[model samples]
Target: MSAEKITAEKRTEFGKGAARRIRREHKIPAVVYGHGAEPLHVILPGHATMMALKNHGYNALLELSLDGETHLALTKQVQIDPIKRVIEHVDFVAVVRGEKVTVEVPIIVVGEAKPGTLVVTEASSIQLEAEATHVPEQIEVSVEGAVAGTLITAADLPLPQDVSLLVDPATLIVNVTEQVSAAALEADLEQAEVEAGIEKDAPETEAAADSE
Candidate 1:
């Protein structure tokens, strides 16, 4: 994916109050660090930054402009408001072209499994080592016509020629299991209620016993 170029303003103030003041001006605070250089604190445009990350997906690379200099940074972390869903803070790491970087790419499942089987995903993402510029947007796993008892592991994932998996090969990723029918679910629920001493129509049964 391509990097989104954003103009960044150097931030001189810190703390919660300063951050609030920055957000009041339609900007958000961010930090760029890594490669042994000092951390650079800056303020970024709120709408632009959010849109860039949203359109480019997670682990997006950014080309930043600060003063008269231009630098490349990769997204490391993002903090967002729980209720408002606005970005609060972002962290980035400086990187150069051709550098092998480790990043977590989201796993996307393609195609439908065989009928009567349900596809269950155990992990949502997988780690990979690849060039900073060519970091994949996502990893795809296919379950087309896969039958029950089918299991897909990390090693079974397909990757670009230059990319490599960083996690354990045997890590479970996705599996195809038999789908539980409605009747089965109702039966299990009834059994659970009985075990918990919650019998159905208990009041009616008590009234009938009293009459007898």
Candidate 2:
């Protein structure tokens, strides 16, 4: 992965009002801190930053140009509006080339399991320590021809060179089990409804009332 170049302007104002004003101007409030350096407050172009992050994953390495100086940083956190789903604020951490950083990489299941078997994923993502600039976008687990009772753990995952898993080796990632029949699933749902004291409506009773 390559670092995306984003121009940032130093921010002078602080507070909710200032942040709202910045957003109104189609910018996002951000702070950069790492390497024992003081936090730097800045504003980034909202559309450009969102597009860059969408192209790259959350851990995107960014080349931030501020005051004619460029610094390498990693996206640490992004705050978004829950209702509007708009980017609100972002936190970045300064990192140097070849530095290793621990981050969560999404898990992607590939291939189909054996007939009559169902693949269940226990973990959707895993933690890994990798070079800050070369963090993987996702990890893939193959279930091709996997039979029932087959299990995959973190240690069984194939990783790129220099990348190390930070999760427990025994952690279960995927489990292949016999597929449950539709009738069995329905029976389980009925049992759960009974345990919760939920009663199904009787169509005959409704018909009787209609006749009255």
Candidate 3:
């Protein structure tokens, strides 16, 4: 999980107008704060930042070149326009090499379960601790040939080196259950209609009942 190199600029202006100006220039206004240091207001290249986050997800690690020096940071938060769908602002946490950071990585279920068994992922993401530079992009769990009644927990996830699980091992991640057939579903629906005293309307003879 090497950091993506991005060139950033120092931001001297403030306020909504200033932010709009930055966005108009195709850049995003961001702040870097962490490690007991004052927050540094900066501007990041919009396209590069967006692509990096898109490719690596929210836990993307970045190496920012600012003012002839380099700073290592992890993306903490992002704000996007609701209508325009463009990034408005970003917040970064300054980090150092070998420092362990807690992050949530999405669980990717690959392969297929046994036929007639539906695989359901109970947890979409898992919380873990990893080094700043070696954080995993996503955790992959293979469900190939899994039969019904198969349940995978957080402890079953295979982690990479230097990574540790921060979540409880008993946390459910995937559940494989028997799938109901369409015929069975239709029969259940008919039974429910009979139980509720509701009948299908008849052609030309149907009338409003129970009220009218």
Name model 1 segments beyond 4 Å from true.
Answer: 186-203
- lDDT (tens digit, per residue) of candidate 1 on 143-204: 99999999999999999889999999999999999999999999999999989999676598
In the predicted model 2, the residue pairs found to clash are none
**Residue-level lDDT tens digits of model 2 in 13-56:** 99999999999999999999999999989999999999988988
Position 183, candidate 3: lDDT = 100
Worst 10 residues of 3 by lDDT: 203-212
Per-residue CA lDDT of model 3 for 1-212, tens digit only, reads: 98999999999999999999999999999999999999999999999999999988879999999999999999889999999999999999999998999998999999999999999999999999999998888999999999999999999999998899998999999999999999999999999999999988765534545345
Candidate 2 similarity to native, TM-score? 0.86
Q: Per-candidate TM vs. native? A: 0.89, 0.86, 0.89
lDDT of 3 at 173: 98
RMSD value for candidate 1 = 2.4
lDDT of 3 at 2: 86
Q: Which wins on TM-score, candidate 1 or candidate 2?
A: 1
Model 2 clash tally, residue pairs: 0
